[model samples]
Target: MTPYAIATQYAVTLLPETDINSHFYEITVDYRGHGLWAITRHRECMNHDGDWDWEPIPSERTDEWIAAHRFDLDTALRLAKEAAPHVTVNGITAVEALARSARREAQS
Candidate 1:
């Protein structure tokens, strides 16, 4: 099977308005399938129009982002699903993709 990474977007709206912190973000989970996985989180930006959008911020891969070999693919996918309501992968939402996979599994 081809190695794939699941990218899911998330937002923090429940935080108090007075809280000065990131509100929009994306977390990309790269599962190596050996109980190893890496999580890279990117913060979304708000443009002048006040619309939330993604802007790739280039930076070095420091200790902040690294692989953790402690979970299986199922756990990784579950995490992807937990990022629901805002998770989009390859034009298809994570919930949709996961539901489709479930249907296929059920058929098999």
Candidate 2:
């Protein structure tokens, strides 16, 4: 499926150190089939040792992550459409791809 991208305002740090740390991050919640979603948070931000500190964390279709992060199917679709409604593949938007994937799982 075409992964939907969500750009969060900015990373919240306890210390609020530098301007670079305040930059926005494009967090992608990828649908890994079987009603599973994994969130890829802060891909650009690296640790002092040069490792991806924020990796893709797994979540269920009906998890609290969906509520807190507002990543449910409908919400994701709305956000994606608002961001780039014109982007399509075979006339299907990112959210439509996600919906199709969900429907496929349900029908099976």
Scored by Cα lDDT, where does model 1 land?
Answer: 0.41
Question: Which numbered prediction scores highest in TM-score against the true structure?
Answer: 1
After superposing candidate 2, which stretches have Cα over 4 Å from the reference? 1-29, 32-56, 59-66, 85-108
Question: In model 2, where is the ten-residue run with the lowest total lDDT?
Answer: 13-22
The TM-scores, one per candidate, come to 0.29, 0.23
Scored against the true structure, residue 28 in model 1 reaches a CA lDDT of 46
TM-score of 2: 0.23
- lDDT per residue, candidate 1, 20-78, as tens digits? 32132244445434455433334432322323344343354333222222234455445
TM-score of 1: 0.29
